[model samples]
Target: MSHQRARGQPALVYRTKTIIDARGHQVAIVDTENPTPVTAVFVPQRSSRAEVAGQQDIDVTRMIVSSDTPEVTSWSRVSWDGSMWDVVVPPAYHHGTRHTRHYSIDIRRRPS
Candidate 1:
């Protein structure tokens, strides 16, 4: 297990990721440099809403703004699943060149 700190918060973040299709089926497994603390399955769009709605395992800290030429937008939510605060990148952002939907999990230290 790996450990990460989110800034001023004493909470530690454990990161794990699940990749699912639009129908909510696990399509691919996300490989990350972060340690797997707890496993959580996620759905795109709706999942972000759930976290914002305060119904799930993580809190959203920041939304990432990606710019190529036209400027693309992706969201990252920092949420604590009790043990760790995780930064989850949901499927709305295209992680693949040919794909528009895919998810990745990352860890961030809250800026002190």
Candidate 2:
């Protein structure tokens, strides 16, 4: 997880990065002046299906919720339904970033 402290705006939470394929030899540096805006969801515990479903009613492009347990390894993906957010969990593992209190939703574009 990363932190962004702008000049005037409040400190913002940034995304978490993991080394995908760092070879034993060379180092490739990617210069990104504009970082992608992300919507992070902080889940403190394991959330039930009902809890996840209830959140769909809100039009939150990026969201995260937590419970008292850590049983949920990944979160269900949420889609924009023109007016609100919709939850969709596919057959594959819906992995998200885990933090001290919640999970993060990383995307190239911010949710509108």
Least accurate stretch of 10 residues (summed lDDT) in model 2? 4-13
Where does candidate 2 stray beyond 4 Å? 1-24, 28-32, 45-112
| Model 2 Cα lDDT, one tens digit per residue, 37-98 | 33434222222233563452222223343222222212222322222122322112234454
**Span of ten consecutive residues with least summed lDDT in model 1:** 1-10
Error of 1 at 9 (Å): 16
lDDT of 1 by residue, 20-97 (tens): 779989753323344323222322332232346545443234322221212111222233434323353442343544
Q: Model 2: how far is 87 from its true place, Å?
A: 24
- What value does the lDDT take at residue 44 in candidate 1? 32
What's the count of clashing pairs in each model shown?
A: 8, 10
Best by TM-score: 1
